[model samples]
Target: MHGLFRFLALSAALMLGFSALASAEPRVRVETTLGSFVIELNPQRAPLTVASFLEYVKAGHYTNTVFHRVIGNFVVQGGGYDTSYVEKPTRSGIPNESGNGLSNRRGTVGLARTGEAHSGTAQFYVNLVDNAALDPQPSRWGYTVFGQVVEGMNVVDDIGAVATGNVGPFDRDAPLQPIIIKRVEVLQ
Candidate 1:
């Protein structure tokens, strides 16, 4: 009787552990003018980046922001500029987590930064193709990919196909008609 009780308790604990692992990932829904998509964030791999992104989402930073940069067959960058081409304020930069084993594959979401490493804050881009060049190398840091679009990738593709040219402060690749981010919400 004692042996059977111990086995039952261990099985129950293992089942609970497996269930926790299954639901460990958090998801967010991004509503854009074109459409909506869901992103599954990999906090286990890029904890800091995911946390920072969630902070921005909860603070309503992405609302009304335009997808300012759209390059066909390349990437669609946004989460910074407003409709009037004004840059929104952001918190301090998060450390680069590019080496966390996530690649810049198509539909993967990555933090967009300048030349400086560890300079990512709020701005993100979705790769339209497998951008192996954006991955980390032996001597250089790469863009951190913390999440991937799991649904409505067609909407992202549509945004990528928009007409782009020099607009406002951008020299080129700015969408002729702004692709606005309507809202971003965390999923329970």
Candidate 2:
């Protein structure tokens, strides 16, 4: 009987420890030409996506990148293009984590991918509105929402308001004046 009680206690303790670690969300401060904003990444909800984003953050992959796509009332995307509009190489795509329970709400950050279901690479976007249409449905995969802006959402709004026009091959939605991502840093 004593051994059984001891085993139960050990199991309970282990579970609590694991739960605490899982709930500890990672955060990053994204510094851009518009302003700086902090994002709290929910690893509990999107583990693989969070890990991949952090890998890029730590490696300085976002520095000097420009928000290549910006649509008012829609999204501001970056993390893969430089000031000269050159696409930066990234690690292979990650599996879609759209079913992680996060939504495409305003201020939420999502991975940018091609039409393929699981093609998220280095690019990401911040939703400017409650974009429910981008949420996952039974028949299709949606963009994965891995984080949300915890501070300076006004900065995101400011970026969304920038004038956009044709820039080379991108004949629409590119910011007329570049919104550069000066740097990105991981926060404790």
Candidate 3:
């Protein structure tokens, strides 16, 4: 009878310990001067994007990056520079995994890209609305969207609502007042 009681107690202790450890895992949080936004990464579809982004997160690459572009009713982009407009050196490009069937819907996060495959570095964008046109197509390349803004869409909205102007010879739309990404955390 004493042995049984001892076994039960040990089992209970182990379960509780595991639960505590799981709960204590650090969740990634991106706190901008504008507001705080949280994201839960998806490693399934956009593995490369997830790996690279998480690598940067672990290394604190996004600590002082700025949201270089903002287009109200469209998208807000960041993870490229500081308030001084100094660009950070990014990791090697990841393959265009936009073939993963995810759409660039509102609140969704996608890697920024140029016209070439494997061109996405650290730059990313948060969808302002359902930008379905950015979705993957069989005939053409698309941006890889590996996660969504699980929390703090209000912060994203706030950034999107900021007034934009051209900077550093950028003729279209950039933030006149550089909005900085103060920090990014990976939530457990």
Candidate 4:
């Protein structure tokens, strides 16, 4: 009886540990007018950034947002603007996690920000190519790379190929027809 009890206890602990490991990383499916792509977040590398992004995803904050900027061979940025070219309200900026060893490679998603290093809010961009210039340097903070496209990368490429021009406040790289993000759903 004593040996059986010990075995059961160990089994229970192992199951619990496995459960925690399974949920440590979360994946999100971004459904756009063009198609869908899956992003697997690296919470271990950028915990705060991943948490902030998941919070927005759970709240359906990405619905109706447009991929306003489509710079081919560069990036496709969105998650802030609406179909009307209006910026949505976002939570306060999070700390930069660019030093976490993730590179700005193709299919990897990075947080969008102004000149300030910690100004990343809800907006993010996927690298269309290996943008080595966006990587972190000793003198400057680079964009935080939190996740990467695990599936449907071709869909991201299709979105990147869309024609862009002046629209509303943006004088360049705005999709001539809005490439709407229908929704972003977190995968189990």
Candidate 5:
């Protein structure tokens, strides 16, 4: 019965492997004034970005933050400003993970940054459409897409449709009426 033992061992190992794969991805629920949406992060593709994001979620850093930038047919960005349009202090920037094979497509969540290649911090954006321009090229770094919206994309779309202008400190593209992020919670 050596062959039978080998078969049972292989089946048990395969089951464990599948379970590990399923649990590797972590989900977070983002509660906002408009509504809530769930995002599933790809740690396998973006380890540093995912870890940093989870740390922010566990620290309640996203509570009361406003989706400061909303570009129709483009992206909705937030997680770095409060209702008053004040910038929230963030930890040092993380490395650019743009080459991780994730694309800045519609419903995908990406880490926002400045002109610097590795300047991504606490702020993030949700793509409203397939933003191929945001993807990395052979010469330059692109935005790091670490997660995607798994539910309530309608809420994201509604947020995208808000009226935006020069509100608060932002010169433009700031929502006239703040779309506040109530909180972000990590799903067990």
Candidate 6:
């Protein structure tokens, strides 16, 4: 009877541990000169987005990249530039996973792409408002929404509220003072 009780206790403990680990959403600590924001990535819903982001995280690709664009009502974009504002030639683009049922809402993170449907590289963005139009709908191609800010919505809002300018040739939502992603650390 004692052995059975011990076995049950062990089983219960193991179950609880596994549950915590599985439900404990993995967060990415984005350290910037401005501040640090720990953003959680949801792999269960956004597998491709989470996998792509983890790939970059493992390779340390986001270090020193600038948050190039910041539209107040849209998103604060990043993971594409150096300290001098020269953009990096990113890894080959990933496919559009926008059909994954996630919506682009305030504090949610998603990939940044060109006009092409599958042109998203290392660059990503954080929506400042509930951009429902950007979300996947029956008639439109949507930007993939992978994760939301588990913490640090304030930092995202601060980044969204920064002054922006067209530095050289690019216009529209360019940050006057560049915000650098100093590093990204994954915490599971």
lDDT of the candidates, in the order given: 0.95, 0.94, 0.85, 0.95, 0.96, 0.85
Give a tens-digit lDDT track for model 6, residues 66-114.
8888889788988988777788766788888998878898888998888
Cα-based RMSD of the predictions, in order? Answer: 2.4, 4.2, 3.2, 2.3, 2.5, 1.6
- TM-score quality measure for candidate 3: 0.85
Q: State in Å the error of residue 91, model 6.
A: 1.8
Show the lowest summed lDDT stretch of 10 residues, model 1.
Answer: 21-30
Q: Write the per-residue lDDT of candidate 2 for residues 3-105, one digit (tens) a residue.
A: 9999999999999999987777888999997899999998888899999999999999999999989999999999989999989999999999999889999
Q: Cα deviation in Å at residue 164, candidate 3?
A: 0.6
Error of 3 at 106 (Å): 0.2
Model 6 regions lying over 4 Å from their true place: none
- Which runs of model 1 end up more than 4 angstroms from their true locations? 1-23
Per-residue lDDT, model 6, residue 62, is: 90
lDDT tens readout by residue for model 4, 1-188: 99999999999999999999777678999999999999999998999999999999999899999998999999999999988989999998999999999999999999999999999999999999999899999999999999999999999999999999999779999999889999999988
The true-versus-predicted C-alpha distance at residue 12 of model 5, in Å, is 2.4
lDDT of 3 by residue, 1-188 (tens): 99999999999999999998765423368889998998766776777888888888888889888898899999999997767777789877888888887889999899998888779988889999999888877687878888888889999999999988878645657888878898888765
Candidate 5 lDDT (Cα, 0 to 1): 0.96
The list of candidate 3 runs beyond 4 A from truth reads 1-27
lDDT of 6 at 49: 72
lDDT of 5 by residue, 31-83 (tens): 99999999999999999999999999999999999999999999999999988
lDDT of 1 by residue, 1-188 (tens): 99999999999999999999786789999999999999999998999999999999999999999999999999999999998999999998989999999999999999999999999999999999999899999999999999999999999999999999988999999999889999899988
Better of 3 and 4 by TM-score: 4
**Candidate 2: which stretches are off by over 4 Å?**
1-22
